[model samples]
Target: MPSPAAPAHPAHLSPALTLLLATATGLAVASIYYVQPLLGLLSAQFGVGSASIGLLPTLTQLGYAAAILLLSPLGDRFDRRRIILWKAAALVAALAFAAWAPGFGALCVASVAIGLMATLAQDLVPAAATLAPEAERGKRVGQVMTGLLLGILLSRVAAGSLAAVAGWRAVYGSAAVAVAALMPLLWWRLPRFVPATQAGYGELLASMGRLWLQHAPLRRAAMAQGLLSVAFSAFWSTLALVLAGPDFGQGSAVAGAFGLAGAAGALAAPLAGGMADRRGPQAVIRVAALLVFLSFAVQAVAPASLWLLVAVAVVFDLGVQAALVSHQSVVYSLDPASRSRLNAVLVSGMFVGMASGAALGSSLLAAFGWRAVPVLGAVAALGAVVVSRHGRRA
Candidate 1:
């Protein structure tokens, strides 16, 4: 058989294909996170605690993990367009359920459903890379990645503002409408390729065990990204709590502004993509860890300083986004045929990392208070930097 084609340079992609995937990524990835900024409102409507409101993201993440672990292999076994289409439809249903949810219990169920359905993005990214000309895979993937980052960072601000005005259900309802409208277009526009494996779900999941044993890079990327995510989670998950507290005593609108100001973080995608294109992904991780460490350190000093928070947000976002993009770039290089499964491993690990960090930050605040939280995050990134320097963190 002919050898598989080599991956291409960023400049190799046609602008049209890159733009299409980027647009689709913005729409699809946003669906997965529309609930993040709405958690406060959802909690009020259902009457839950911070830790319980925490479960909104936690359960959604768990559902995402399950989909990646269980469903992503189908991309290798079946037609990807159909999988994307079906998952989008399922997502619409889930979002609708969330919109009309009557109580906390129903909301949790809907969030899980949405999380499971939204893993279509896992399949979508692999499909984008697979369809790209080999030479431009990184560039093309970077374009889509910009959309992913934008959706992730902006959704908090966007959803928060919209949630305040129209209510959380309205925010989800609007997304559901957009997702439902886009499904047919996606089903039509996506490219086609033959499936690589027809393994059953059990067999596909078993492949992950083998994957874990064989790929050192995959494991390392997961660790590096996971730690970086924990650092990020430390800030985002508690920003509202701190802002809403006595010192700042700010409202959600103020808290949401941080998300917008932090948009600078997404700017690093191109830089990270370029770095991975040149020096190799390890270099990107090293720099990202250092930046993340600085971001946390800056926050430690800037307790009531908006300007300082903004500066740190920029640094922190750059570190997190760069590390994230670089991590995905590495994983894409490893296995072209089963990226969804690989994504399942990587994305789920990231959420768990964030969840762990968020939990840790909350507990620290409860005991040592908010002043101590940034120090913990700084220590996390610094620790990663040390580990990376030794060639162990990856």
Candidate 2:
């Protein structure tokens, strides 16, 4: 039997198709984040404690994590296009349901459903990787990732603006309408591809464990990105509190506006992809590590001017996102048949890192001060640099 890792040179994906895939991925993934900026409004409307309302985003993350582990591997055992379409449909329904949900309990259920189906982004990413030639694989994945990043950064903007104008529920309603409209475009444009693996569902899932134990490159890529994610999460998680301190005396709105600066950094995704193609993904990761380290180092030295902090957000996102694209490029190259499962493992690790970083960042900020937060970020990025360097030598 021929190896699945051997290049097939898939020629069906056109530029138009690629754009649609990227857009679809961006829109699908945005659903999980829309609630973050509306938590206070949700608490007021639902007559709930702010602490209880926090469960909306928490459950969404939990659902997304579970879906990545459970549903993502199905792409290898079935048709990826079908998986994407089915999940997109579920996502549309979930969004609409959340919009109309009568109470907190119903909204919580809908939020989980939305998260579970948001794996559509995960499915599209691996599909893009599989469709591109080995030489251009990083570039293609980067294109899709750029959209994914834009969606994450912009979702807060859209949600906050819409909530101000209409109300919190209107945000979800608008998203549902947009997603419903996107379904036909996806159905019309998506290219279908058959899976090579004939393994039963149970066996397919079991193989994920074997793949983890078997591939050194996969493990390295996951570890490197996971560490970088810790730094990324640490910054964003405590940013609002830091801004609210006496020196800054800003509010969450100011913190939210900083996402626009971060969006500027996502533009590097395609460029990083192209570099990974030419110089190898490891080289891109090396540059990314250095950029992340420098971003924090500057923050530690320079006092926190708002403009300076904006620049820091841009630089920090640029480095972390570049490393992410480079890491995915390496993981996708490991096995053609297992790209989706590989992504599941790699992304799962990132989530774990983000959760840990959020908790640690919060603790550090409370115990010490805003000054302590950057030191934690710098140390985490330094850890990422060490891991990437070791991976390079390996």
- Judging by TM-score against the true structure, name the best candidate: 1
* Model 2 regions lying over 4 Å from their true place: 1-11, 14-16, 39-58, 100-109, 128-142, 238-253, 277-280, 297-302, 359-375
Residue-level lDDT of model 2, residues 370-390, one tens digit each, is 777678778888888888889
TM-score of each: 0.87, 0.82
Candidate 1 per-residue lDDT, tens place, 268-308, comes to 55678788889988798889889999878877876477677
Candidate 1: which stretches are off by over 4 Å? 1-20, 134-136, 333-340, 363-368, 392-394
Query: In model 2, where is the ten-residue run with the lowest total lDDT?
Result: 1-10
| Residue 285 miss distance in model 2 (angstroms) | 2.2
